[model samples]
Target chain A: MGAVLLATILAIFTTMILALWRAIAGPSVYDTIVGVNVFGTKTVLLIALITYFSGNDDLIDVALVYALINFLAVIAVLKLIRQRDLAAAPEGGDD
Target chain B: MTELILDVVSGLLLLGGAAFAVIGGIGVMRFPDIFTRLHAGGITDTLAPLLIVGGLVLQSGFTLLTFKLLLILLFLLFTTPAASHATARAALVAGLQPVTRDSTDQKETRSSNS
Candidate 1:
C-alpha cells in the first residue's frame, strides 16, 4: 500500500512538472492563469495524500486552507483582468 | 482482501487522474490559443483533483481526514469552473481571439468592422 501511494505521489509530481511547463510557455495570459490554477489543485491533493501516508490527519486542515486561498487568488486575478479590460475599452460610445 | 482490492483500485484511479492532468498540460502547451488551453486546463483542474481526492478518501477510511478531503473536493468542484469561466470571459473581453479551423469567419468579421 505504501508503495502504491508513493507511486501515486510520484505520478502527481510529474504532472505538476508538465503543468509548470504549460504555465511558462502558454500562448496567452489566461492560459497561464489556468496553469496556475491546476498547480494549486495538485498541491492540495499532494498535501492531503502526504497527510494520509504520514498518519497525521491534522494536515488536512492545511489542505483546506490552501484550497480556500487558491480560490481567492484565482478570483482576484480574474477581477484584475476584468478591470484591465474596462480600462482598455474605447472611450467614445463604441459599446 | 478488501483492503488490497481498495488499494489497487485507488492506485489505478490516481494514475489515471495524473495521466489526464499531464495530457491537459500537453494540450495547453500545443493548443494554438488561449481558449483551447483554458479547456485543457479546466479539465485537469476539476477532474484530476477530484479523482486524486477520491483516491485519498478511499485510503483514508472513516476518519476526520477523509471528511476534510471530501470537503476539499467539493470546494474545488464548486469553484474551479467559476474561475475558469471568469478568466475565459476576461480574456475574450480583452480581445484574445479563439483559434478556428477556418479563417473565413475572422476575415469576414474584420472586413465588416472596417
Candidate 2:
C-alpha cells in the first residue's frame, strides 16, 4: 500500500510540473489563471495523499482549509479582472 | 484480499486523476485561446482532485480521515466550477477573444458591437 501511494504521489507531481509549464508559457492571462486553478487542485490531492501515507488524519483539516482558500482566491482574482476591464473601457462606449 | 484489492483500485484511480491533470495542462498550453483552455482546466480543477482524493480516502480505510477526505471533495465540487465560470466571464468582459481558426471576422464584429 505504501508503494502504491508513493507511485500515485509521483504521478501527481509530474502532472503539477506540466501545469507549471503551462502557467509560465500561457499567452493569455486567463490561461495562466487556468494553470493556477489546476495547480490548486493538484495541491489538494497531494495533501490528501500525504495524510494517507503519513498516517496523519490531522492533515485532512489543513487540506480542507487550503481547498477553501484556493477557491476564494480564484474568485477574487476574477472579480478584480472584471473591474479592471470595465474601468479601462471608454465612457459611454466600448472598444 | 480485500485490502489488497482496495489498494490496487485506489492506485489506479490516483493515476487516472494525474493523467487528467496533465492533459488539462496540455490543453491550457496548446489551445489557441482562453475559452477552450478554461474548459480543459475546469475538468482538471473539479474532477481530477475528486478522483485522487477518493483514492486516498479508500487507502485510508474507514476512519475519520476518510470523512475529512469526503469533505474536501465536497468543497471542491461546490467551488471549482464557480471559479471557472467567474474567470471565463471576466475574461469575456476583458476582451479576450475566443479563437476560431475560420471565424476571426465574427469575433471582430462582436467585439466591435460591445
Candidate 3:
C-alpha cells in the first residue's frame, strides 16, 4: 500500500511538472491561466496524498484551503485580465 | 481478505487517477489553442481529483480525515466548471477564437494577428 501511494505521488508530481511547463510556455493569456488552474487542482490532490503518506491527517485542512483559494484565485485573475482594472465596470455585455 | 481487497481497489483508483492527470497534462501541452487546452485541463481539474480523492477516502475508511477529504473533493466538483467557464468567456472576450475544422488554415493568421 505504501508503495502504491508513493508511486501515485510520483506520477502526480510528474503531471504537476507538465502543467507547470504549460503555465510557463503557454502562448495565450488564457492558456497560462488554464495551466495555473490545472496546476492548482493537482496541487490539492498532491497535498491530500502526501497527508496520507506522511500520516499527518491534519494536513487535510491544507488541501481544503488550497481548493478554495485556487478557485478564487483563478476567478480573480480572470476578472482582472478581462477588466484590466479590478475596480472597473463592465464595458459591454459579453465581458 | 476484505482489507486486501480494499487495498487493491484503492491502489487501482489512485493509479488510474494519476494516469488521468498525466494524460491531461500531455493534452494541455500538445493541444493547439487555449480552448482545446481548457478541454484537457478540465479533465485534470475534475476526473483526476475525483478518482484520487475518492481512492483516499476508501483507504481512510470513515475517519474525520475522510470527511475533510470529501469536502475538498466536493469543493473541487462545484468550482472547476465555474472556473473553466470564466476562463473560456474571458478568452472569448479577449478575441481568442476557437479552432474549428474549417478554421485550421485561419488559426495561424489569427493567432499571429492577436
Candidate 4:
C-alpha cells in the first residue's frame, strides 16, 4: 500500500514537472497561468497522498486549504487580467 | 480478505488517476493553443482528483478523515469548472483568438499560394 502511494506521488510529480514546463514555455499569458493552475491542483493531490503515506492526518487540512487558495488565486489572476483593475466592475455591469 | 480487497481497489484507482494526470499534463504541454490547453488541463482538474481522492476516501473508511477527503474532492469538483470558464473568458477578452479549423485551412492555403 505504501509502495502504491509512493508511486502515485511520483507520477504526480512527473505531471507537475510537465505543467511547470508549460508554465515556462507557454506562448501566451493565459497558457502560463493555466499551467500554473494545473501545477497547483496537482500539488493539492500530492499533499493529500503524502498525508496517508506518512500517517499525518494534519496534512489533510493543509491540502484543503491549498485547494481553496489555488482556486482563489486563479480567479483573482483572471479578474486582474480581464479588468486590469481588481476593484473595477466587469463589463456592462453597474459600478 | 476485505482489507486486501480494499487495498487492491484503492491501488487501481490511484494508478488510474495518476495516469490521467500525466495525460492531461502532456496535453497541456503539447496542445497548440490556449483553448486546447484549457481543455486538456480540464482532465486533471476534474477526473484525476476525483479518482485520487475517492481512492483516499475508500482507504480511510468511515472515519472523519473520509469526510475531510470528500470535502476536498467536492470543493475541487465545484471550483475547477468555474476556474476553467473564467480562464477561457479572460483569454477571449484579452484578445486571444482560438484556432479554428477554418482559420487553419485558410492559413494553409495562403502558405501554399505564397
Candidate 5:
C-alpha cells in the first residue's frame, strides 16, 4: 500500500528475476542450487513485507515457517547432489 | 513528531535493504563461479533481512507483531549462513572446484539454449 513497501516488493521481484537467470542458465548443477537458495531467501523477505503491508501479523508465522522450510530444502538438495555425484563416480581408475 | 521520526527511520532501513538485495542479485548473475555467487547471495540472506525485518519491527512497535518479526529475524540469522556453508561444502565434497585465477581455462557460461 505504501510507496516504500511497493518499491521494496518490486525490487525483490527484480532480484528474483536475476536469480531465475542462474537457475535456468547453469554451467554446473551447483549454480542451480545456489540460484534456488537465493530465490527462497527473497521469497521469505517478500512474505515478511507483505505481512506488514497487509497489517496481518498472522502471516509472520507463515514467513517463519517458510524460512525453516527453505533451510531444509537447501540442505536436502546439497545432500542429494553430493550423494548422486559420489554414486556416479567410478570406484576403479586406470593406472 | 515521534511518528515522523519512526517513519523516516523505517523508510531508510527498508530502502537500504532493498538496495542491498538487488545488488546481491545482480552480483549473482555477474560472478564467474558458484562460490563467488554464493558470496554475493550471502548479503541478501544476512544484511537485507536484518535491515528489512528491523524496519518492519520498528514500524510495528512493541507488540505481538514485533515479537513475530523478531522470530523471523532470529530464524533467518541462524539458518541462512548454515545453508550457505552446507551447500558450499557439499559442492566441494562432490568434486566441484572453483575456477583458478591464474589458469583462465574454463569459461563458465550460461546455457545457450536457455
Candidate 6:
C-alpha cells in the first residue's frame, strides 16, 4: 500500500513538472495561466493523497480551501489580463 | 478483507487520476493555442481531482471526511470551466489568433484577403 501510494505521488510530481515547464516556456500569457491552473489542480490532488498516505484526514479541509482559492486566483488573473488588454486596445489599432 | 480490497482499488484510482493530470499537462504543452489547450486543461485537470477524491473517499469509508472531499470536487467542477472560458475569452480579446483546420474556411479567408 505504501509503495502504491508513493508511485501515485511520484506521478503527480511529474505532472507538476510538466505544468511548471509550460508556465515557464509558454508562448502566451494565456498559456501560462493554463499551466498555473493545471499546477494548482495537481497540488490539490497531491495534498489529498498525502492525507491518505499519512492517515490524517484533517488536511481535507486544506485541500478544499485550496480549491476555492485556486478558482479565485484564475478569475482574478483573467480580470487583470482583460483590463490590461482594454487599456492597450487604444494604441494597438490592428491587433 | 474488504478494507484491503478498498485500499487497492483506491490506490488504482489514485494512479489513474495522476495519469490524467499528466496527460492534461502534456496537452497544455503540445496544443497549438490557448483555446485548444483549454479544451484539455480545463476538463481533465478538474475531473482528475474528482476521481482522486472519490477514490480517497472510498478508502476512508463513509465519514464526514468523505463529504469534505466531495466538497472539494464540487468546488473544482464549478470553477474550472469558468476559468477556462474566461481565459479563452481574454486571449481572444487580447489578440491571439486561433488555428483553424478547415480548408474551406482557409480558402474563404484567402479569397477575402486577395
For model 6, fnat equals 0.81
What is the TM-score of candidate 3?
0.93
Error of 1 at B16 (Å): 1.8
Model 5, A12-90: lDDT tens per residue?
Answer: 9999999989888876888898899989989999999998788777887888889889999887777667665533544
- List each candidate's DockQ score: 0.47, 0.48, 0.84, 0.63, 0.53, 0.51
lDDT tens digits by residue: candidate 5, B1-112: 9999999999999999999999999999999788888999898889999999988877888998788778878988898888888878766766777645646656554322
State residue B10's C-alpha deviation in candidate 5, in Å.
Answer: 0.3
Q: 4 or 5: which has the higher lDDT?
A: 4
The residue ranges of model 6 lying beyond 4 angstroms of the native Cα positions read A84-95, B103-114
lDDT, residue A68, model 3: 98
Instruction: Please list all clashing residue pairs in model 6, or write none if there are none.
Output: none
The positional error of residue B86 in candidate 5, measured at the CA in angstroms, is 1.3
Tens-digit per-residue lDDT, B1-114, candidate 3: 999998889999999999999999999998888888889998898889888988888898988998898889899999999999999988887788787656445544325324
Residue by residue across A1-95, what tens digits does model 2's lDDT show?
Answer: 78877877787687678777877876666777888888887888888888878987788888989999999888767656656553354336542
Clash counts for the predictions, in order: 0, 0, 0, 0, 0, 0
Q: B12-89 in candidate 1: lDDT tens per residue? A: 877777777677767766666777777888777877887778777788788877778888988988988888888887
Report, to 2 decimal places, the DockQ of model 1: 0.47
On residues A35-91, what C-alpha lDDT tens digit does candidate 3 reach at each position?
999999999999999999999888889999999999999998988887777788766
| Ranking of all candidate structures by their TM-score, best first | 3, 4, 5, 6, 1, 2
Per residue, candidate 4 scores C-alpha lDDT tens digits across A1-95 of: 99999999999999999999999986778888899999999999999999999998999999999999999999998788767888886678531
The true-versus-predicted C-alpha distance at residue A14 of model 3, in Å, is 1.1
List the candidates ranked by DockQ, beginning with the highest.
3, 4, 5, 6, 2, 1
lDDT scores of the candidates, listed in order: 0.76, 0.76, 0.88, 0.88, 0.84, 0.78
